[model samples]
Target chain A: MKEDYKIERVKERINYIEDVLASVAAGDIDARINSEVEDDLSGIEAAIDLLIDDLTDELKQRKKMQKEVEEKLAKIQEQQKTIFQQQSDLLELSSPVSKVWDNVLILPVIGTLDSQRTQIMMENLLEKIVETGCTISILDITGVPTVDTQVANHLLKTVTAARLLGTECIISGISPAIAQTIVHLGIDLSSINTKATLQDAMIYAMKQNQLSENVKLHSLFADSDENEE
Target chain B: MLQLTTDSNWTELGKYIIKTEHDIVQVRQLIRVHAKEMNMGIIDQTRVTTAVSELLRNMYNYGGGGEVLVETGVVDDKNALIITCADEGSGIEDLDLAMSDGYTSGMGMGYGLPGAKRLVDRFEIKSEKNIGTTVRVMKWR
Candidate 1:
């Protein structure tokens, strides 16, 4: 009778372990086999609890690493955004559009020409023309290093836009390299007035502006003479 | 290991370590000078220089920076300009897919390989899995 009671106690402990394992399998990480009952089952319970601890630690570590990587990526993205902003600002400052002469706007472009900077340049030029109502504009590319097909297209567009606003645009400072690139790209610059240097374009603009002024003066004098007569 | 196709009498025009955007610019300028010396004409100089720019950028962007060697040599008894870029980065898994136009693994226009090919007179690429990649291009004078 005493041996039978001992066997029954062992079975009860086995059933307890089975129940705890089931709970753990059902996603209860907190479930643990009671190891106080010193028996063969106690050793199994200790091993299982140790396994759960290791798995929990590993999962926590992975989560921490994931968060750290995500934070670093976000920081990199923010830095990139700031750098781009600074680049565009530099482009804007480099390609300053201003009314350097009375009734004449001048935009001196330096550095390499890309699509983005060209777009910015066009916008800035158009804005100045509208703001100052200048009838003559000069685009000086003396400092520009290279001009690709897209950049040439942007220049054409800028000239066209200026013409729509009743402004005559003159392009100057075509370096040999740029001239070669334009020819290789087969761009048609025949309609646009081009000069070898900014000084040349400025001289042309001055001559045109002064001729119109002289014409206006002559008309005004003629009107006064007619009134007197 | 890289094998040279030409004899050892090649004149080293320039060598560049491409790591950043500024380095790419330097490479382009260097090639332009060399191309000018070879009398490749202004248009061809621009084309080859642009090709170098694209290739160097690919090495920096995809290969995490690499070494580029520019040499002037004789090919088929004619003056030739040879450019080679080698990198110890993850090798391309699918070279065909990478060479195809508009096949981009990252945020790029996917014109590096094929565009460079189009700009040069001859192009070749050698890559091994986990070993690295090397690109060679030649332009005749």
Candidate 2:
């Protein structure tokens, strides 16, 4: 009778071990066999519990590592976005379209001419022209390093586009090298006005502005005199 | 005779409709972004973007408006940015004259076509009178 009772006890313990293992396999890492009495099966129960503990620890470490990696990736992406925004901001700051005179807008272009920068400069100048109703714009390129055929072509296009908007664009501060490059490339700037320096362009713009005003004033006087007659 | 060819492997990146002056600016911005993403140097970026600007201006001025397709492909085992511009305006009667420098039928400086050709690696233009015109340009990285 005692032998049968012990067998039944062992059988119950084995069934509990099977249930705990099945729970662990189903992703319940907290399941454990709490075997208290010391016996032959006790050693196996202790080993299985230790193994589950190690597996749970390992899984926790893996999750932490994954979270850390994801955070670093997100930080890198944010930095990249910031860098891009700063670059565009620099481009905008590099080209400042300002009204230097009553009817003159000056765009002082410094550094090397690239298509992107030039396009921005052109757009800004055009928008300013429309906003201020300016008739004369001086594109000062004194600080420009070089002017290839492409750069010269871009300048010409800008001037032409401005003319279409009823604004006369003057190419000022043209270095001798740029002049030579333009001529060598067979580009004709005959139709467009050119000035040796920004000072000269400014002087010309003011004079032109004064002349147009004088013409309007004279026409007004003429009309008044005719009305009096 | 200008032969029009098609490549099956070119992947389209973006498309822009050229109608207003603001559209031109937007297209230039898009080209710059794509060129930068492809790791093109600033000078090459400028050249390609400038060439596209010239083509866009031509379309806006003469063609009344058009569409530009930006694509990427492999040419001669090198990565290439391919731009295709199509216009529904009346086509040029003489392609040779139009391609010549300083031979503009309009008010441009006559440097649009030839200058654009000089700025790219490969340039192909096809036109049919009263039908339309298509210009395809490729720049290799």
Q: Clash number for model 2?
A: 0
Give per-residue CA lDDT, model 2, range B26-101, as digits (tens).
7877997898889997767767877787788788878888999999999879899999998988988899999998
Every model's DockQ: 0.11, 0.06
TM-score of predicted chain B versus true chain B for each candidate: 0.92, 0.95
Compared with the true structure, what per-residue lDDT tens digits does model 2 show for residues A1-229? 9999999999999999999999999999999998999999999999999999999999899999999999999999999999989978988999899998898999999865666888998899999999999999999989865454446767888999999999999989986645654554357778889998999999999999999999999999999999999
Itemize residue pairs with steric clashes in candidate 1: none
lDDT of 1 by residue, B1-141 (tens): 344465687888877888876676677788889888889887788778767766776777778888999998987787899999887778788999988876778755565677678778888898877777889888999
Candidate 2: residue B25 Cα off by (Å): 1.2
> Once model 2 is optimally superposed onto the true structure by TM-score, how far is the C-alpha of residue A92 displaced, in angstroms?
18
Give residue A168's error in model 1 in angstroms: 2.2
Q: Is the docking of candidate 2 incorrect, acceptable, medium or high quality?
A: incorrect
Superposed on the true chain A, the predicted chain A of model 2 yields a TM-score of 0.64
lDDT of 1 by residue, A95-130 (tens): 789898889999998866655677888899889999
